[model samples]
Target: MKKATIKDVAKEAGVSISTVSNALNNSPLVSEDTKNRIIQIAENIKYVPNMNGKMLKARKSMTVGVFSSSVSGHYFYILVDSVFKELRRRGFGLNIVINKDKRALLSNVLSKNFDGIIVFDNERVGEHEVELIVQNQIKTVFLDRDLNGADVSSVLFDSYKSGYDLTKYLIHLGHKRIYFIEGEENTYDNLERKRGYTTALKEIGVEIKEEYFFKGMFEESYAYNDVISRFRLGNSQIPDAIVAANDYSAIGCIKAFSRLGYRVPEDISVVGFDDIEVARYFTPTLTTVRNPIARQGIRAVEILMDMMNNDMPGVSEHLAGEIIYRDSAKAKVL
Candidate 1:
């Protein structure tokens, strides 16, 4: 069995190699009938383009490499979706590389034959990873998280503001001694959100309590157990409300109370961040900071394209998170 090439397709179609190339690349010079005939012959011979070799020869892959944490029901998915759409619109292809470990992520991304790369959830990135990325000399843009030492383009969202504003809103509703459910320990977003929470409490003359915080529990079962443990341990003061780092944690808190025979906003108010799609459809719609997850994706690609064109200037961009009020949170009574 012989591998087919442009020459083979051309020979089979009784046309020149250039004609085959033009047809495959969708060049306008080839007639519609000729293009169809060439494509049919290539298909019959199972001739697919060798992108890897082509990229090597061209010295520019014309493809953007995307490094995502995961492509499931996470915030990263929203960003990846937006980037894919924007890359296509800009006439560039995309490649997604997923790995949680910094070393592995960097190895996979840097080794790939690509012109540019975008890093999502930058918390996993380390100094070594930074060195790798910088050493590669590839155009790069970071989304959702920032690299401390990387002197490159980034599009960020104000997680701190999201946390601060949401907490402040709860405080204005008379919530004091608010409990904070944190996100993953190493995540930059979690740290910023906590800062915002602390800032709000400080502004209201309310001191943050060590006992009012919990960790290692981001899911519904974890939240329910934490609430139960607090009750069983005779913890007298249940904060007026619980503020989660994101909507998933917030929803978990709500479910915990519901199972324990408590009503939301009526018994105790709760607020979450990110305002993921499920927030709106919850039993009592969530009151959260509406993170522009999808838009961030779209902007990332647009910026990366600018970087690709050598027109990218040194600039840091941040998108504000909007607050959406729903039935989940309410002012506490004096």
Candidate 2:
């Protein structure tokens, strides 16, 4: 005898493939009697549940998940778009889950509903959850963060380099009164970019002022409120330059500055990170660094597919981005 298969079981049970699958997975759709009948028929055919034939048939789901820590995906829209297209091309389904509850996120992954997952949210995920992911043999690719294990891959953007280049360019333009708008407190990208900015400033022998550092959550509202609070409290003389964490915050800073009777590249030069679509057309044409969202998305999906198909161990990739200079930032000639 060659071997018994799901086809053999299905043939004996006189049921569809989906029906057999549902019965094997214990789906509620199948009534108790039908479920017992299928199991009895399968057993009669010598089809053990743990046999390689049965296990392999039930292993794959052909679905991948993309989870993010942020409430919204606006900042990383390009990445999500690329991932969506790539997944479609590869005949895989994409599930985007946003971070709202930690337990829910872990449970979803552990449930093995997806063949693989590309995680962008790690803030709420704990070590135990990661261990469970490893134990369950879940395929994962993390963005801008690392989970050290054989089962996890990491794809990190070169935020540090981009931030360094952007800040150094502003410094070269003779801007010293630089007000740096930083992003979220716990994010890896935020910390790396801030380090790059501070490093560039230190190399120039500029005394870093505490007041020049504005803590932000990489949001328009945070940037806007920072400006309002500073202006209301007085002594809020316009800085020579404003380096926002990203384009959204940069745009918000521009709006606030306009209402405060300030002009871009005139009174205070503004620079943004992440070359979003509107950055080039915005008033004064914002100068910013290139954010390689599309590239990251494509590469992440590629790695995930490899892992899913070839049983490859997790790997890491670090990509670099460059600065895009336009008219927003002006030289503050001393």
Best-performing candidate as measured by lDDT: 2
User: In candidate 1, how many Å is residue 150 off?
Assistant: 8.0
Backbone atom clashes (below 3 Å) for every candidate: 0, 0
Clashing residue pairs for model 1:
none
lDDT of 2 by residue, 1-334 (tens): 6556788888888998789877766678988788778866865665533222222225477778887666354556788889999999999888888766664576566566777888877576655556556656677888857554566888888888888888888888988778888888768888888888888989988888888888667888889888877876558667888888888788888888887778888888888888888899999898998867788999999998777777677888888987888988988856
Error of 1 at 33 (Å): 59
Predictions in order: lDDT: 0.75, 0.78
Superposed on all Cα atoms, model 1 deviates from the true structure by an RMSD in Å of 13.5
Question: In candidate 1, which residue ranges exceed 4 Å CA deviation?
Answer: 1-59, 121-123, 148-151, 216-218
Which candidate wins on TM-score?
2
Clashing pairs in 2: none
* RMSD of each predicted structure: 13.5, 10.8
**Candidate 1 local lDDT, 205-271, one digit each (tens):** 8867788786624465666677776665555576689888778888878887776667898988988
